[model samples]
Target: MNSLVLFLLTVVAFGSCLKLPSSFKKCDRKTTDFNQCLSEAIYGALRILDKPLPSHGLPSLYGVEFPDVFTMGNSTYGLLQKFYQTRYIGLSKPENINAKLDFGPLTITLTIEATYSQLTVETEFEAQGTIVLLPVNVITPVVYTLVNPTYTFTFVLEEYEKGTTYFRVIDSKIDAQTQGLKFDYKGLFSNKVLNEEFNNAMDEKWRQIWILFKSFDEVLFAPLFGTIFNDFLKKVPAAELVDG
Candidate 1:
């Protein structure tokens, strides 16, 4: 009788230890890897922001000084310049990109080092300190929009994967308000002869910007984001992959 009781006790103990689902185990491991990959990728890409803007045929609409205010054909184009200079543009180049991942309590922090050039009137924007990850659900899809007068961009990610994933953007314009300007340019900068040229121009500008943003969806963020996600997956244990 005592032997039987001992056997039953051992069985109960083992069963209790096996209470967790296999999938849960796999997900826990995958989640850790995913967080690490995200940190690495963000750090690397943010590093690019530090580098000098490549001379990508972006004409240097030369003038006495950075225009206090200017119009692009019919669309007004000053707010973005002001915003870029004040918020996005950097004074120096980034020296390093650092990232940390917290698996116990999922979170990621990124830090960047930078420097500026005083001579060329050019600035290099770096990732500076760190960007933290609030709570995120890895399984669900997430959408982010980067909006500007020139473009209305959208980014969608289904799951963080290394290669097989999609990201896209769309450009659009706000209504009626074109920062007060007029012209008749088409294609790259549309200047159609609609009933309300000003309104139409503004709409067209927004539409064109969205289109441009969409075009860059695949080219700009895919490879960069993918590589980072992939690296993270690799860190996951084999046992976890099977269970997940």
Candidate 2:
């Protein structure tokens, strides 16, 4: 009896997850590239497409965390006129692949959240029986966070592959846009006045992190075409893109 109950619960859970979005209904049998069609459907649900190549509406939701703790010398941040911090803090909201570039690139508008970063330098002299090496040997555990804030992305397609008529992205890079960005630092510094000064100074800043958010759609694109790509790839008669 317990086994049967467990099996039924599992089915119920999975059934809800497998529910296809009403968006896919647009992908009818006549569509030549089922892989492409499926891609259009899911992303299109987010927003109507504008430019053609790289088909718009791709979802961009990815989070990256650096494993290593930073310990940069003070000379490195001399340009920024700042020191190191505690830990890195930052998060991103899912963005949509809306605009496209003629040179072969795309842009995504994102909401970058705030971060909490702190800096600690090592010194040659001991503080309370601890040896430190000035700012050069700083054990900087940076905390940089970007609370949900509006931002845009512009990146160029780097590489791609295809087994069926569909495509898969390999990599990409950032193009022109707002000044290189940094996340909100108010929460970390705990100084509203100082934070405001920094925010106001670099109001137009943007980050490679945001670019990561946009480019990630390429990661999802190929996978989305997975089942369909295989279906046509293996199907007899070698389906043509237009009618397959």
Candidate 3:
């Protein structure tokens, strides 16, 4: 009788562990769709930055797709964390700091800020770093220099206009090297064209980051947290079990 009772109890416990296949089917589908939308939006933004703009007019022509998704993903995550802390948690006071963006041959670092009022964007060349020289005892040392340049271009947008809007940069300060290096070593270097292209590229990056923030807020955060909160309330047990 004792063995039969134990067998019955084990079978009941096993049956209780089974879950209906349809229980989470809709949630799974929704999660997949959300991921796809986020991926495409991110891809489109990156496509805008991949190539350098051709030298022609005030706003040079170029696609903004390149730079692996991993780097951009990090930037997006950092921005989201900042948003949650500043807007939701009401923690530390917001302030400006130098943020760095690196492309293969070029790096644009900016001093930006997040506040209750608006978002400020700015960019400058990276300057403060060590330069490695080849052959320490060579007759003539070939130096591989790392230059960090400073730039200040501030574009402020009202907090309300952040997600569904765009801003134009009317004025900007350009570094001499960037302005002079428009084309290859032999080609004609136009300072005007170089500055215009550079500024346009920076603007595109700013917009891309903004788009990422919107996607995270609307799709990922909204669905995941909402479901988790609801489920948590439903599943919490009213009483604790004591050890027999």
Candidate 4:
């Protein structure tokens, strides 16, 4: 709803589009090939999401559906109309990716953008949307476009099994930037002037929301990959893949 939430969700929702990588060689060799391979593995994995994934019978890519109105953490926004056609779009491979070892941790950093994404809630009268924070229980279409988003995270393998791998996101940071934002509302409490005033007010105050977005959403989003990556690594450990 605000810049923080916009930035945080921007980073998170789109990440769901990625698929786990297939295989790797041996992990014993710590060489340039290892870093390059790991980087390419992540890139290839995310590139797979350029195609849609099935949801029941519908196609979804990083798709997310909220009830007509719902609350997540401290944010809430929804439309008066709910439809099955809503889907998430524009999740692509990050422009750059780097993966390496930091002593005992596996570190990865990715540069990404949501320039082509369309996140909006549609209704009969007005299809409103916002990348900024919205009021609780408000009736409005929602859209947020993040032009650039980057996340750097370090993972430590706390536990590893012969057939399973376990890791945790010990340290993480996000560098988020936006090209522009849009928030349009038309409903019960709207005088055209009042709506414009409110929207402008929110845009002016968005910076206050960044701190919360980073603290909360970072925790929510980063671990998602750890669980899945842990599984992937269990199947393809660096020791086994790094040509040792």
For each candidate in turn, the TM-score is: 0.23, 0.30, 0.17, 0.51
- Candidate 4 segments whose C-alpha is farther than 4 A from its true place: 1-29, 51-91, 103-137, 163-189, 234-241
Assess the local accuracy of residue 51 in candidate 4 as a C-alpha lDDT between 0 and 100: 54
Q: Alpha carbon lDDT of residue 45, candidate 1?
A: 43
Global lDDT of each candidate: 0.29, 0.31, 0.25, 0.43
- lDDT by residue (141-208, candidate 3, tens digit) is 11111122122222221111211221222222222111111111111123557535644554445444
RMSD of 1: 20.8
Residue 23, model 3: lDDT of 15
lDDT computed for candidate 2: 0.31
Order of candidates by lDDT, top first? 4, 2, 1, 3
Task: Tell me the tens digit of each residue's lDDT in model 1 across 38-137.
Answer: 4345334444434422221111111102222211221122111110121122222223223332222322222222222211222111121211322211
Residue 16, candidate 3: Cα error in Å is 20
Candidate 4 — worst ten consecutive residues by lDDT sum?
A: 52-61
Task: Give per-residue lDDT, candidate 3, residue 25.
Answer: 19
Number of the top lDDT candidate: 4
Top of the candidates by TM-score: 4
